[model samples]
Target chain A: MDLSLSTRNVSGPGGDRTVVEVGGEIDVYTAPKLREQLVELVNDGSYHLVVDMEGVDFLDSTGLGVLVGGLKRVRAHEGSLRLVCNQERILKIFRITRLTKVFPIHTTVDEAVAATD
Target chain B: MATVELRFSAQPEHVRTARLVAAAVARRAGVDEAVLDEVRLAVGEACSRAVGLHRSHGITAPVKVVLTEEEKNFSIEVGDGVTGTGGGAGNGGDAASGGSDGASSGDLYEGDAEGEDEMGLAVISGLVDDVEVTTGDDGGVIRMSWPTTPAVTMP
Candidate 1:
């Protein structure tokens, strides 16, 4: 039950953004870990955040809730939230939830990073 | 085709571990990842319901999970001993509320985010192709089934 989380610092469209990449499953059990990280980043005034989920194996509604909650938190601070997901299943989830419009989705981390600036 | 059976404590921590093991095994069996994940989620949700039921009834025991993988489909059965009681119905929420045991459904869904998390069961029901609950002499069983086919229906 180990989830691998990776982070990257990029300078892009907006200015400086932190890309937090998540791999493995994001279910009811492990989603809190991601939430904690997102909250910390937001607290540190990391306004623009991109979550790379291409390597994510699964995502439950709880996971989706965390994303929605994080997006709301960032937007409240006049920041933005985006996603990098190439997996068709994961992509379909965002599409099904109509979250594709709510968040900027990119095919690559590079693209997601680029869009942040 | 092979069958797998796993029994573990009903504690929340154990439930998560059991689910991860089930998903990993299913993936190794060549099941599609989405389907595997669907099964895992269903099994986990069902187990959560069972734990809630146990707390209501003042009974504590390990939940048993039985998984059967066929060429065309796979099925999982979650069982807890409480036969001839208010279980096996399609709706576990009702069973927990009946208060036949010491705890009431109200208690199960009472004031916490766990109740919100309980919604996972609804998601599970929607994901799996088939679901059944059987109450018999030994206990109550919740079984979920899915086709081997990939679950992502492109829209």
Candidate 2:
């Protein structure tokens, strides 16, 4: 079975940041695609990234790993990675992993793109 | 109790099937959307762990998933039928040591450093009401359950 998850690059709220909007279930099978996309973005010199997770229905550890890997990749280049997640379930995963304190999570792309630190 | 059992190859693609069936069962059991989401994620986590373990151990056995509904509770058990490689089961033992509630944060993300990757057991522990891991002669089994009724009071 194929999850309906897709990731595409879009302009952020401020029209400066790169935003990746992801939709559908992100499990072990689909996470690699997101990972590849994030790696490709980082390799292309796109540093500041905002992942919009409002359309994500489900997320497992594999998905979380991809996000963490992306963060590390961007951080190595002195860049920042932000996440836009408002769903209780999606936020719960971050909280469980104690990653809420590690990553900056915002409720909107506007706030995430505007965050300076 | 209505029970549904499935056995498939220990592959990543099969996790999606397990999650879909588990979600459908939870929805039909009158579980709300929030609880159904938990069920779907928890089942996916379990199946993913089983598949990863089997692959690491070079075991090509099928992973088994069982979904059972009784009263207002829904439970899922995901396991693999491969023979253990002795020390390969150590991780399962550490995970199972968290007991029935499975709320031990250490057991979930034991040695993961910041930005380090780990399994989804901790996420499963947070989403489900109860979690248990058992490693026996057959293989490792992760059992998780959730109540159909919402436990948290919504404002």
Candidate 3:
């Protein structure tokens, strides 16, 4: 299916960061898209990505891989990637995988962006 | 913009393939990064559920996935046999209570409180905004819809 993806730029205490708003279910099928976007952003010299998952309804291992992979890529370039997830289901995955400690997770995009700065 | 339909064998490997195709389609459609990840998660859960159901019943037909991108909704339809309805409640244990907490220890069917770690219909229902299950003369179909506008780059 055509999963809806929304993108915006947010500026705050964290300086300038790209906020990627995800609204839909994420799985192995769609993880590549996110990976590609992260790669492109890295190539363009844009780091500090904040993925807003408040609107996301679902996420799987492959989806988790994409996030972890992005974190690795961003860190390699001396950049950082954070997540803003509110859904219990999505958050549960992060908490279970102990990935919450890996990436800086915030309650909202504002908090994540602010923290990045 | 356009819809992509794919039919694949009822195997774990094909499920991965479906996710790959779905991701490619979403990227070509200009979907953002985080959003695309969710789509993949949902699709994987759905396909895995279908595989488990089919395996239980011994049906050897390719599972069909129709990925359609409408004006304001992105929808996925995954179907199996004429009556792929049962086994819905088995996974409901995970929903009623988030008990497991995410511990993938050995096989889930052993002695876990929240049944097994079978992430299928329950996972999809948890992730998607709207889930429609239809059973009739045709067959059983699961339709998942997400209400959000895609990030389309215009020329």
Candidate 4:
């Protein structure tokens, strides 16, 4: 079975930050893909990222770990990683884990990309 | 009262199906719609943890899931078939000393899988209001339950 997670870079090369659009369920089965993408972007010097999760239908602890790991990777380079998500269910997981304090979540991609460190 | 039993190979991909079925059953059991997402996520975490344990022990047995709808509650039991996995705590540290299957994949994971395993359990506990974890020689079982309204008869 194909893992339901999908990710795409929506931003062009010249922007100060890269916007990655992610959709589908983020779970143990597909979180590796997100982790790989994040690692590659950080390696490629795209430190600042805005992950647009508006299309995500579900997310679990493993997916949260990947996001937290990504945040750590970017922070190592003195950069930040923000998320654009408004889904109550999706946001609940962050609140449950108290990770809302770690990730800067916004309703719009523009808001995530515009926020200062 | 109603009961549904599902068994599948210890694989990550199968976790999604388990969650879907659990939520549908929970809804039919008169669980609140707003809390359906919690049910789905909790089931996913429990099933995923079972699959991980089976894989870590090199066990070929499938993971077992049981959904029970009572008069005022919905419960899910996610059980693993890994026997003698040692480490009653199910931590990565003691998995290597388990039994025959212990050495199968221990070297590859070292302790990373254990960390994820702990985190998965933590997430499960957070999502479930009434949850229980028990580990013994027979293996481990995570039994989680949520309150429901009056049972709705199925069509």
Best model per lDDT: 4
TM-score ranking of the models? 4, 2, 1, 3
Evaluate model 2 with DockQ and give the value. Answer: 0.26
Model 2 gets an lDDT of 0.72
> Residues B1-155, candidate 2, lDDT per residue (tens digit)?
43888898888888899888989988876678867777888888878877877776678878889888877687788887655423222343333333233223323343242111234666666666688777688886788777776455578
List of clashing residue pairs for candidate 4 = none
How big a share of the true inter-chain contacts is recovered in candidate 3?
Answer: 0.05
Specify the highest-TM-score model's number: 4
Candidate ordering by lDDT (highest first): 4, 2, 1, 3
Using TM-score as the measure, name the better of candidate 1 and candidate 3. Answer: 1
TM-score (chain B) for model 1? 0.70
| Each prediction's DockQ against the real complex | 0.05, 0.26, 0.05, 0.23
Say which docking band candidate 4 falls in.
Answer: incorrect
lDDT of 2 at B21: 94
* lDDT of candidate 3 over B15-114, digit per residue (tens): 8788778877766555566667666766776776666556666889878888887767677888776383544533543532342332232123222212
Candidate 1 lDDT, A1-117, residue by residue in tens: 456798878898668889998998886567678888889999999989989997898776457657766777787788888898888767755543344556678888788778734
Error of 4 at B64 (Å): 0.6
TM-scores, chain A, per candidate:
0.93, 0.89, 0.90, 0.88
RMSD of every candidate to native, in Å, equals 8.9, 6.7, 12.2, 7.2
Q: What are the per-residue Cα lDDT tens digits for candidate 2 across A3-110?
A: 443444455544457888888878888888888888999999888888888888778888877887787777777788889999998898787666676678999977
Better model by lDDT, 1 or 4? 4
Considering the two chains of model 3, state its CAPRI-style docking category: incorrect
The 0-to-1 C-alpha lDDT of every candidate, in the order given, reads 0.68, 0.72, 0.65, 0.76
